[model samples]
Target chain A: MADLLRLDRDPAAALRETAQRAAVRDWTCATLGLGESATVLVTELSCAEPGCPPREVVIAVFAPHAPRRQCRIHCALAELDESRVRAAWLAPTPCGGSHD
Target chain B: MTDTNDKVPVTVLTGFLGAGKTTLLNRILTENHGQRIAVIENEFGEIGVDQELVINAEEEIFEMNNGCICCTVRGDLIRILGSLMKRRDRFDRIVVETTGMANPGPVAQTFFVDDDMRERFALDGIVTLVDARHFGQQVDANEEAREQVAFADVIVLNKTDLVTATELEAVERRVRAMNALARIVRSDPAARAAVPVDSVLGIGGFDLSRALEYKPTFLEPEYPFEWAGRFDLAAGRHELVLGEGPDPDMGLALFPAPPVEAEDPARVAAERAFKWFAEDVEANAPGTLLRPAESLAILDLQGTGSKRFPVQVDAPGRYWLVTQHLPEEFALALHDPQGRPVRPGLERAFAAGHTHDDEVGSISLETEEPLDPRRFSDWLSRELQAQGASIYRMKGFLNFKGVDQRVVIQGVHMLTDNTTLGPWGEKPRRTQLVFIGRNLDTQALIDGFDACLAD
Candidate 1:
């Protein structure tokens, strides 16, 4: 969890992070509209809960002087979709959750 | 120690002509960020190179080679990357610009499909830029455009400023319908601003990490010939028949099956009988057996490719019917044409394998024994020279006598690239090679490889 933002863990880890970020950025731009003041960051997290899948891609969007909004798609990078991304984006950001 | 992140990331950018790939490329290059990026653009048509720092790539974008990346220009890609590796600190990332009409399947597949490509390059993602103004018409009129969208991890709907908000939504919807999973972006290419360069360039989506689950066919067994099954047959007159398909080019032969009992007296007699039959067939005419036929191994067997053999068994023993390079699985009947039981109540065992399309397939040879490097080089050169056109790709890791490092061999058509992979790590050494091609002969390849084995 501490090194989740690190892209150098392995080839596969880098792939997961890069792919998730690209997808999240695309979804954010398409849904929230592209502007000069908007910045989007996508992060993939490993779920360590019992019976949960190993990882999920989370998206956080920040705009000019606004509170950060975070959302997550509980699936692999290849399975990320607009519907899922939008659902996660609309969901409230968890309190005290770390952002990469 | 080489870290996995040390491998350079390559982003394959694809889109139809006028898809704003150039706009996006220019934006990434000129941005204030201090990262060094190398751009490889496959020049097409009348379009001049837009990026000042661009590496020109050949425009010959070929079709998929053996369900993977195109090998036609793979050599060029390999050579370019090889040179790039020599000066490691120059570029932080690589962006490959494919022709608008090009299919992204092969380009993305190259990352994990080829050992060398996988070793040097980690695919970041496939970014397909789409012109929002004419995307609806282009997707409907062209299959290549549809394919580009289908394979993209990031779909940049460029020129969004030209389209109305409603049209923008419709274009996004159409792209989603074609590829439900791709990330979609509406790009206002007119805005001299950076178009989310950070999100697209370093994204690790192209890692082929989940390839096994997403595309199981990549792991599907690929071989020119499949060994069916070994059947236990009692010594007797029998006929071998093709089962369940149009006959393919095949070679069938019978070998003396081992005896059940180690000290059995019948085993010695059976070996002598087989030796007698071999001498008789070589000296006499085709399908001829010795005068004392009851003691002969086989009564008469001749011809190739789905022909019946009149086989005789002098003793109560076992035998094997080996089938080579054929679509049809062979089954041995206990009784002859008369329908009497040669061995009662024994069912035929068929090989558990299936056939693929006729155009391309693979042949793999794996052995624990070390190979003579010179002999293998000669055999491979001869094979590739005679049938290189039909042979699309060949790759293998081999053990060479007196060499400590693992020898890696890879080739597409006639062109080949060879190098040593440091050392054999903490694993047993073995030789494994696979050739994907058309019209493959398993026996010939097996014989050739056997000749390369160290004596």
Candidate 2:
């Protein structure tokens, strides 16, 4: 994804990334079998720490009574596919999420 | 990353109970700063007396969950900031008042750990108010008091008139020893946390250059060895006599000295000594011969009498003797083979192992070598996972192999953010990291960082 600040200067790019984020949120809600009460937040975080990808999409699923479930895809929001999201959420992960 | 100029600046206020947090908050609101400022107050108890004290601001309190159990960010803060951004033109800056018992780590980390918050807000600085009259007792009795001082960028010593001049000086010295980087400002006792408004506000404590622009002594790390002496010796055996004192064992290292005219000779010798200290110790009983080698030697001084350890000098040259503890502590002395006392031509004492609080202190590690990126990331992740609960704050500038730009990392507990500031250009490439926390193992941190060095 483009730099957050740079996207501010380029409105078209910002709009595109925002739309992609919304699409990811919808996909996460569907794949997780979340109900309307569940809050699904999809955010793209950029990290410069060594061994970390340049950008990753973090999907946090907060259900009504269950614990929060989070999964990350080491790619930009635009590049994320439905199958990848489905597999990531279906795979058994640790209590919080797979930080790797 | 967001442009700092476009984001709203936030100044966090944290201090112990009875410290002038509310006084400072009221002072900021009444002062003619020519800006509309919003205040966010976090009260500890159910009574909520602070909200009534604040003026000319809307009081909105929201309680929510911070998703992950280990994460410390207040969910209410995230919701409040999100709501405030909708009416961005209503305010120019923000000031958050944390309770006396609150740790400022979570409050500061919220600006960086959250994606939306990171883009919308900039943590300008953390101004800690310290009550001069009750500082000694509060710091001694409470851990939160010490943590607030350790994490402050600007410390306002309030209520100066309540204590004598000598008491104020002692408290200032103690605070300085605990945190060498904070800019200390004395407030008017009569005015109640009143100082120049510019001193607390507009100070870019989180900015890299501004954060590192404190005293030069802050860049100096606390050395492991306390004393180092330069001695010119002949190619013969020398006796190191030690009288019983504190511990049963003493760590020592001898290295060939660089030329006297060499630039930064002390630092040069220290670098070698640190590497040797990190290696496995060669344990020697009393009366055992210690030859000049590339490892640290541990002399066992178990008995209650003077112990003699022979040190062999293979070549006639100047050598440096570094001891883990001060020579005065153990009555350590050296004698040449001719039975003549050899006085050191040069002696230096390192500022080591002196802290305001025993459990809460800071560890600084510095190296000129560029670090391996992958190894550094792995080591940091593992460390934060294991010791995040105790680590209050961490900040550093690193030189990573294959990366030309300098990497700036700032972290609070488990959440960390690393960003490229700029290219190295003409400046020397170096990695400096400072960790402020409780029960920190200095050797373990040093060894872990050393392992990340690029081969």
Candidate 3:
């Protein structure tokens, strides 16, 4: 019963990654009130810093009439939740303003 | 006597890496073409190595710093080309070999936009060499590859031997899809001596007559800025106080009018003083009351609660401010700090429903009615001086009242080249223009051009 399903070779990981990205995109669009024309890119980025963790989910938003906005969640794509995304999206910019 | 001071034609060579550009260039150099060619070699590497690859011939070779010729190295090309022009023994023709991943748009635009570049050098054509083996992958992966083909007058389909007949046909189809007008020259990779030197060089692909008809793709860019406003006011000191935007660092470029020169000596003296203020503002120098050129005095607003700054206007004219966000987001106010409102709460200069692409966008206007030459010139001069930095490239064929020939106006930033193309020749007398830039107002530009039409 232990090795019956072979979870290690699960192809659903790729499918889950895609679905998670779509969910993240949908959530971002809904939260930001972005139009269909707006472009959203979600990726896993690695940072080599003392305080910064190795792997993180990075969300990039490009909407017309506004500057490009990028936010980083300190988690993997599969581990991303709506509350976590909301927190990251609402995080203050480097200049002390809300993320555009 | 031959005019030795005549403008030398510049042919820009562009393509992806390992695309037989060096082969084509070497062929041109070694060939007894009787033309003294000055080659400007631009490579994208830490150390410039492509210059060493060039075959030693009786030609002038200038190596540009390692960077994309389109962006960082563009200024280098202009400066080097300018220096080359000042020489006593000038080359008959100039050739610029841009890095593989280079957009030829800015390079081709240098000739059209720079005053000295236009007077001293003319853009002959952009000849792109396509590596037939990797054409599909390169075109798919690289925007530069696609642009090189799109902007080319000549496309050398090099390394034909590496690909099969079917593959070659597919590559040709893809190349044609990108640019139907470019003359595609097929060259074998094995045959180095058989390079199409004759077909590539001296081809006037950058014909201004045909360039006026804007390419649709050239206009497609998502502009960072969206809305813009143009304000006309009497000569006085004014203040533009910014409110807020989605981004804390909201940027707005204000273009104040250049001082108008009047015949009166008093007016001339006043104009000089006003111009000094404009210069100081543009330079971000402290103590200048008005700074039209700066972004509403962002540098001055450091650690300040209020975002208001004073600007001096010497002459009565129009001052335009193009903002990165919508007018509401950044309620940038233009008013006299001391005097009353000119329009009485009409602080919003001209709130346009301006929607452009996310990057670089374009706006074009075509009118059948002939425009008054003086009015058109004045409008263009003011427009360029104000918003030239954001406006990347502008070219148009103008139909004027008295002029027998059609006037072709080409500009890059503030630099413009206006030349008369001989006669309408039974064709439609139309004024057509295309402006490619970041956050341009299409309706505003169209309205401005329409105003130039004679009553």
- Provide DockQ values for all models, in the order shown: 0.01, 0.06, 0.01
Comparing 1 and 2 on DockQ, the stronger one: 2
Best by TM-score: 2
Give lDDT tens digits, candidate 3, residues A1-100. Answer: 1011111235576467668888988888887787765656565533334565565665666454455576767656788878777767776651111221
Assess the local accuracy of residue A33 in candidate 2 as a C-alpha lDDT between 0 and 100.
Answer: 73
lDDT tens digits, residues B286-366, model 1?
333322232222222233443344455555445444333222233334345355534422212122134432333456678
* lDDT (tens digit, per residue) of candidate 3 on B33-72: 8887777777533222323222121122211211223211
DockQ of model 1 vs. true complex: 0.01
Query: Which residue pairs does candidate 3 place in steric collision?
Result: B221-B359, B222-B357, B222-B358, B222-B359, B223-B357, B223-B358, B223-B359, B290-B311, B290-B312
Best by DockQ: 2
In model 1, residue pairs whose N, Cα or C atoms come closer than 3 Å (at least 3 residues apart or on different chains), thus clashing, are A15-B204, A18-B203, A18-B204, A19-B204, A19-B205, B224-B362
Better of 1 and 3 by DockQ: 1
What does the TM-score come to for chain B in model 1? 0.43
Q: What is the TM-score of chain A in candidate 3?
A: 0.77
- Model 3 RMSD in Å is 29.8
Candidate lDDT scores, in order, read 0.56, 0.74, 0.59
